[model samples]
Target chain A: TQLLEQSPQFLSIQEGENLTVYCNSSSVFSSLQWYRQEPGEGPVLLVTVVTGGEVKKLKRLTFQFGDARKDSSLHITAAQTGDTGLYLCAVPASGGSYIPTFGRGTSLIVHP
Target chain B: DAGITQSPRHKVTETGTPVTLRCHQTENHRYMYWYRQDPGHGLRLIHYSYGVKDTDKGEVSDGYSVSRSKTEDFLLTLESATSSQTSVYFCAISARDRVRNEQFFGPGTRLTVL
Candidate 1:
């Protein structure tokens, strides 16, 4: 199991504040994926980064993959109440078994 | 939003009893998986299937069994429900081989064992 460690288990910030969440792992990954999950619902895929030093943006959110492909980060610009939710980073198992292993997750709460 | 549905969105059962959770999908995807969500545990895989009647265990497969008699329906069964087994269960599917595809998850089912 490739264990991904996500930092800042919990975060609370006022609206309009900027924040960044980090996911780090000692194991190398071929690809990494980010997801956001609201309470009482399943997680929704935010983005997938496959290349080292890659950056993908989804409007107010930016995702970056480490040049070593062992870490990733998510930055949210001008956070809003709608941005509040649990964020998770995942990577598939090695040896061609694409079963994902997820991090514990970071719970973000944006206060309006 | 994945055209997936899990039955008994909420269920309460007692220990030492059998409980089954159902996952149904309309997309006709080839892969299906069952996972459990717990605090500080993220989502742990319980089992997965590659095709009809083909299944395999996952990281947290103890005390749990799954069956997929049809392509669109996957069933998870607990031979003996326990308080430790109480948690939110999610079903996910990948249209292609999981190695090259993204998984779509169902809403989830919350189960309580007393």
Candidate 2:
């Protein structure tokens, strides 16, 4: 099983503060995906990055894949209370299974 | 919100009792998966189905079983419940063969075994 490690297991910040979280792995990935999960709800797909050194933006959030395709980062600008949730990174399982292996995730809370 | 629905959103059962959870989708997706979410463990795949009557075990499939008789319905059954089985269960669907593409998840089912 391929394992993805997420940094900063927990984060609590004030509104309007900027923050960044990371996901890293030793295995090379063909593609990576990010998902945000709110309380009492299932996770929602935020974005998918396929190319190495690729960067994608979603309004206040920015996602970047490493040049080696073994790491990724998520930066949230001017965080708001609505941004409070668990952020997870996933990659396809090794051996071409296409099954996803998820990171433990980073739990963020933005206080108003 | 991909038309995925999990039945009995919340359930509480005693040990040794049999429990089953249902997942229904309207998207007609060809792939379905069952996962359990627990703290420190992330989301662990329990089972998945590629087509009707075709299924495979995931990372944690010991005490759980799944069956898909039709395109839209998938069922997960626990022959005997245990405290260790208590967790939030989620059902996901994908339009393509590879889960690396995109997946739509159900609201989730919180199961408690005491």
Candidate 3:
């Protein structure tokens, strides 16, 4: 099974601080996706990185895919309480499967 | 947001009872998926359908079954509910776009089995 390991399982930061989360895997993926899920709701797609060493930014959030396609990172700048949620990284399963294998996820709490 | 909706947003049932969760989509995307989210496990795929009547199992498909008879609906049924089955269920849809494996997700359904 393809597994994605996420580091810093839990994160707590004060508003205006900056933090980064990492997702690493031993297997190569064609594409990688990042999602943020709030309590009592489903996850919302934040970004999709298809090429190695690709970077995408959404407001205060920056996402990067590794050059080996085996890892990714998410960086949040000037975090706010609204940024508190569970962040996940997922990769499509290999061989004719579109289903993705998800990381354990990082729970972020931004205190004001 | 994906034009997906899951019925029975919250449900509580006894063990051994049958439970079914419905996922409806308006986008008519060719791919539909069912996943469960728990405290430690972020999201695990239970089943997915590529097209009408064409479905496949995921890593954790032990006690769950899915059916997709039409383009807009997918149903997931728990043969016999167990306490371990309790979790938040999400339905997602994706298109054939190569660059974007990004799936649109529904609001989700919460289930608790006693």
Candidate 4:
């Protein structure tokens, strides 16, 4: 089983603050993804990083995949109240496996 | 919205009682999944179906069972509810793309076992 560990399980900040969340693993993945979830709703995908050392940006959010493919990160610049939510990192299982390994999630609270 | 939905958005049942949850999708997606979300546990896959009448176990499949009799419906059943099973359940649909794979989720179902 692949284990994914996320840091700063809980975070709180005021508006205009920039924050970064990290996801690390001992196992390598072919692809890594980041997702944000609101309460009472299922998680929605933010970005998918397929290659190592790849970066993708969505508006004010930036995502990076580690060169080892065992880690990933999400950085929010000038975060707003709407940025408050749980962030997750996932890796799809390898070798004909379709199940994605999920992180416990980082609960972020951005106050206006 | 992915046209995915879960029935009985909220349910409360006692221990040793059988409970079934339904997942319906209109997208005709080839893959359907069942997951449970708990604080500090994120989402754990319980079961998934790759095609009609074909299903497989996930990381946390104990005490739970799933069936996919058709292309659009997947069902999850708890033989006898347990307090450990109290958590928010989510159903997701994904259509395998040649380029990349993405999953679309439903609102979710909150089940509390007493």
Candidate 5:
């Protein structure tokens, strides 16, 4: 079974601070997806990175896929209270699998 | 908000009791999925249906069962609820577009099995 490991399970920072969270796995993947989930709601897709060494930016958030396709990272610049939420990384399973496996996720708490 | 809604936004039941959750969608999407969200476990798929009367088990499908009799409704049932089964459940619909393959989720139902 392929697994996605996320680092810094919990983070608490003040507004205007920048932080980075990571997702790593030993298995290679064709694509990876990022999601942000707030309290009492389902996760919302942030971005999907397909190519190796690919990077995508959305407003103040920047997401990058590793060159080996075994890892991904999410960086938040000048975070605000609205940035407080659980950040998750998900990847499609290999061998024609339709199920997308997800990481444990990194919970961020940005205080204003 | 792809026209998806889950019934009984919050439910409380006792162990050994039967529980059923409903997912209704108006988007007419072919693929509908049920997942459970827990701390440190993220979203784990319980079951998914690609078409009417066609369903498949997910990574964690031991104590759960699902049925999709119509295109717009998917049902998840727990024959005998257990304390460990308490968690927030979410229903999602996907267009299955090979390119983006993004899933739109509903508000989710919080089930507490005491």
Candidate 6:
């Protein structure tokens, strides 16, 4: 089974502060996705990076895939109270199985 | 949104009782999956169905079973509930094949076993 580990399991920051969450894996992935889940709800997809060294931006959120396809990172700039949630990283298993393996997740709280 | 729904939003059951959680979809997606989320374990796959009546066990499928009789509904059954089985369960569906499709998840069901 492929394992993805997320660092800084919990984070709390004041509004307007910046934060970064990391997801690392030993196995290579064909595609990687980031999701944000609010309390009492399932996760919602934030971004999907399919190529190595790929970077995608959505408003204040920036997502980056590793050059080796074995890691990814999410950065939030000028965080707001609405940015508080659980962030998760997922990758589809290699070798023709599209089953996804998920990281434990980083819970971020942006306080105003 | 993937147009997924899970029934029995919250359930409290005794050990050794049978429990079933229903996941219904309106998108007619071809792939469906069942997963359990725990505090330290994150989300673990219990089972997944690639098509109607075609299902496969996931990493943690010991006492759990699943059935997909129609394209819109996937059922997950716990033959004998245990305290350890208590957790939040989520159901997800993908429109394209598992190889290249994004999965849409349901709101989730919270189960407490005593």
User: By TM-score, how accurate is candidate 3?
Assistant: 0.95
Model 1, residue B95: distance off in Å is 3.2
Top candidate (lDDT): 2
- Tens-digit per-residue lDDT, B1-114, candidate 3: 668999999999999999999999999899999999887777888999999999999878999999999999999999999999999999999884765577889999999999
lDDT of 1 by residue, A1-112 (tens): 6889998999999999999999999998888889899989998989888899999999999999999999999999999999999999988657867477789999999999
* Candidate 1 segments exceeding 4 Å error: B96-100
Candidate 3 global lDDT:
0.91
Give the best candidate by DockQ. Answer: 3
Candidate 3, after superposition: displacement of residue A25 in Å?
1.4
Model 1 CA lDDT for position A77: 99
Clashes of 5: 0
lDDT tens digits by residue: candidate 6, A1-112: 8889998899999999999999998988788889998999998988889889999999999999999999999999999999999999988756667577889999999988
- lDDT of model 5 at residue B50? 85
**Stronger candidate by TM-score (2 vs 5):** 2
Clashing pairs in 4: none
Q: What lDDT tens digits, residue by residue, belong to model 6 across residues B1-107? A: 66899999999999999999999999988889999998888889999998999999999999999999999999999999999999999999876444446778999
Q: Model 4's DockQ?
A: 0.54
Which residue pairs collide in model 5, if any? Answer: none
Candidate 5 lDDT score relative to the true structure: 0.90
> Isolated chain A: TM-score per model?
0.97, 0.97, 0.97, 0.96, 0.97, 0.96
> What order do candidates take by TM-score, descending?
2, 3, 6, 1, 4, 5
Per-residue lDDT tens digits of candidate 1, residues B4-107? 99998999999999999999999999889999999978899999998899899999999999999999999999999999999999999887443435678899
Candidate 3 versus truth, CA RMSD in Å, comes to: 1.3
Docking level for model 3: medium
Candidate topping TM-score:
2
Candidate 2 regions exceeding 4 Å error are: B97-99
Instruction: Give each model's whole-structure lDDT.
Output: 0.91, 0.92, 0.91, 0.90, 0.90, 0.91
